[model samples]
Target: MRRLGDLEAEIMDRLWTWDRPATVREIVDDLNRTRPLAYTTVMTVADILHRKGMLRREKSGRAWSYRPACTREAYSAALMRDVLGESPNPGGALAHLVEQLTPEELAALRSALDSVDRGAPGDGPR
Candidate 1:
């Protein structure tokens, strides 16, 4: 996984929330909640996600329907690991990251790590 731009993240968010693949018109309508965007822009974002390996697209009734290749949480955690895993000492990098977090965030992160250590993400993100 790699760091995604704002548009790519938003498109991925939509796909994660979706129960099924969505067409260009569906994405355009959903994006309308934030701001007006062109159909082409939405379509382009889907294309970018496909290139990034975040999404799978298929032709359906003269339109392209797109779905996420993995859950957003899985993708996010994979990306986090990819970015942090590159450091010579991931433990040190993780410690530094924890040092920068707010107390409330630290508690949340503690719980999340505890959950992962127990077995799997269980009720949270992978």
Candidate 2:
């Protein structure tokens, strides 16, 4: 998967935080509260995200209302997988990542691994 640009990441953040489909105007207005941005620019980026299959859009009046094609967790997992794929030793990379996790996070990771070992539905191949 491709990495998001700063603006695109910002836009996605808004959509994900809002947890609903949003129009370009809504995104621009929200972003403008922190820094100025053009409506056309948000619209263009939204279009690009849609084409990249990262976003799904529907016609809302004359404008498109956009939402993430996948949940934020899914996106993050994909990014982690991408990074691991780039490593010469994915196992070592994963070990390094696990070492950096807090106790609570380590517990969660262990639980997730347990679920995978138990043949959880969404767990990919063994």
Candidate 3:
């Protein structure tokens, strides 16, 4: 997976948050805090997402209702995979991934891993 643009990621965020399929108008409404998006602009972005396999759409009267193609975690994992694939050493790649985390994030990761070793699920997936 390639890096998503800001608008694309925002749309995906909206999709993932929705419990039901949303029309372009609904997505635009959610995003309106940033700017006033025209209906056609929202529709265009949604359509692009569908073509990229990042959105699922169903007929909703005249327009389509769109939802996430996958959960947010899955999409993030895909992006991580794409980025990590370019690294020369898997171990070094993992180290680099760890290095970017804030202290709190690193601690959370350690705590989660400890729980995993104790035969438990903790902190949930990213």
Q: Which 10 consecutive positions of candidate 3 have the poorest summed lDDT?
A: 91-100
Position 65, candidate 3: lDDT: 91
Clashes of 2: 0
Q: How many clashes (backbone N, Cα, C below 3 Å) per candidate?
A: 0, 0, 0
Give the TM-scores of the predictions, in the order they appear.
0.61, 0.63, 0.60
lDDT (tens digit, per residue) of candidate 1 on 13-63: 777888589987998998898888888877877888798887888999999
| lDDT (Cα, tens digit) per residue for candidate 3, span 4-112 | 3677888887777766789888888878977877778778878888999989999999989998878888868977775655453555544444335678998887777
Q: What residue pairs are clashing in model 1? A: none
Writing each residue's lDDT as its tens digit, candidate 2 over 6-105 gives 8889988889999999999999999999987878888888899899998999999998999999999997898766655545445554443433457898
Q: Which scores higher on TM-score, 1 or 3?
A: 1
Task: Evaluate model 1: give its TM-score.
Answer: 0.61
Q: When superposed on Cα atoms, how far off is each prediction in RMSD?
A: 11.1, 11.6, 10.2
Among these predicted structures, which one has the highest lDDT?
2
Count: clashes, candidate 1: 0
What lDDT would candidate 3 get against the real structure?
A: 0.76
Of models 1 and 2, which has the larger TM-score? 2
- lDDT of each model, Cα atoms only? 0.76, 0.81, 0.76
